[model samples]
Target: DKRIVDWTNAQNEWKRREIVLKYIASKGDEHELYALILDNRFVHHHRSVTQVRMDLNIAERTFNRMQEKALWEAARIIPANVLVEK
Candidate 1:
């Protein structure tokens, strides 16, 4: 427990989102794409899937694939114990 870094305030989802951004940024070249999609979908929560696809000029299928990849990577970054299922 002492080793795990948990600076995010659980009551404030935005803090967790910031941690997610930092973790994603620490990744490789793919981080940009992952960051963009994840930021819009989860971090910012202002852009819809269609808006992202339009902004990127990618087809729905491609967007879906990228979104899936982003989610998978984000899932790996966050600790399992910290995540609560509804």
Candidate 2:
């Protein structure tokens, strides 16, 4: 059905890209990098943002900035779909 197809498409789009996201995160600072994958399904570790923040012992504002940077970096670096013709 439509829901199944949509879910499959969503999963497909994120799955491969998540691998690249981890690679990108690994290229940065250790704690800073955690913002990219913590509590993410692709990483297989589930924790709330506050829990992660507490684990990291960082202030909420700092965590917010880190999360924003991680997200935007992921957004900026992840490639958009392009049709390739052979």
Candidate 3:
């Protein structure tokens, strides 16, 4: 059970990185991308941030910040008209 838990956690982290990559390639927002990454079942398999950076060729903090920025921009780009007036 311990191994399974560890494996699952690691896998989730890897998936998070993968999701971030996909979102970046697609020009997705940073904030939304991060939120998406943090969502359950996505974090990544790697335990150390350094390992992630080396493997993914990106600094973990940088990736996180970018994702956050992208999400913020995405929200701003949304059309207000799309929202129904109260």
Candidate 4:
């Protein structure tokens, strides 16, 4: 079923990767983190890009740009502005 293989799955996969990246980053495992990201099952995998781009509702370039922006935001070094008084 081609319809079943459309943007919905791609979007879901992308969201899953978004969370997974955050989770891995939290774990602080430098060695396995790269491998997990590169694994084919993850949406960010090298081979999945074509299908993800074509199937997603957004344009390929837009999606790529958004992903890059998200990575930058996640990696920003600034600490939280609001400090707890306790």
Candidate 5:
């Protein structure tokens, strides 16, 4: 029972993350924004900010600002009720 509960929690967390990623990827400047979020290490393991900036050819300050904005948007986009186990 305990192990099942733990596994369920982990699975739910992974699902929640996937939902958020999909939501972000679907809405607005999808390609650029998603790439910015992914490349700048918003959700998954990613390249360092410096490397991402170089790869994306974005300014450091702009990248930082976008990363912040992306996080804020992701927080707002994520459903509050999704975490509640059904």
Candidate 6:
């Protein structure tokens, strides 16, 4: 039962990550969107939000807004179980 639970957790995590990445990739030519992914460490190596802000040359408020928007978009696009293959 423990093993099954662990496996289920792993699968869920993978699915969540996949959905977020797909959402990010769908937004074409939005540097802020891509930068949010990098800042959040969704892909590639992780970096501090401060570093991401500096690298993207965006202010703190802007970075926070972008992060919030990216998360909102990902949440909006995540499919209900009825729409996903078992």
lDDT of each: 0.78, 0.62, 0.49, 0.49, 0.69, 0.65
- Residue 79 deviation, candidate 5, in Å? 4.0
Model 3 lDDT per residue over 3-83, tens place: 999899767655555555455446635444444433322243424445444544657788666546654543454345322
The reply for model 3, stretches above 4 Å from the true place, is 28-86
Clash list (residue pairs), candidate 2: none
> What TM value does model 3 have?
0.33
Indicate the residue-level lDDT of 59 in model 4.
75
Q: Looking at model 4, report the run of 10 residues with the lowest lDDT sum.
A: 77-86
Local accuracy of candidate 5 as per-residue lDDT tens digits, 2-84: 99998998788767877777767777674457545653584465668887778778899988887787766766766775534
Instruction: Encode model 4's per-residue lDDT on 21-44: one tens digit a residue.
Output: 565456555423332433332345
TM-score of each: 0.72, 0.61, 0.33, 0.33, 0.66, 0.58
Query: Candidate 1: which pairs clash?
Result: none
RMSD of 2: 6.4
Which of 4 and 6 is the better model by lDDT?
Answer: 6
Total clashing pairs for each candidate: 0, 0, 19, 0, 0, 0
Q: Highest TM-score: which candidate?
A: 1
Model 6: which residue pairs collide? none
| Model 2 lowest lDDT segment of ten | 35-44
What range of 10 consecutive residues in model 6 has the weakest lDDT sum?
Answer: 77-86
Q: What order do candidates take by lDDT, descending?
A: 1, 5, 6, 2, 3, 4
Using lDDT as the measure, which candidate wins?
Answer: 1
The list of candidate 4 runs beyond 4 A from truth reads: 1-5, 29-42, 45-86
**Overall local distance difference test of candidate 4:** 0.49
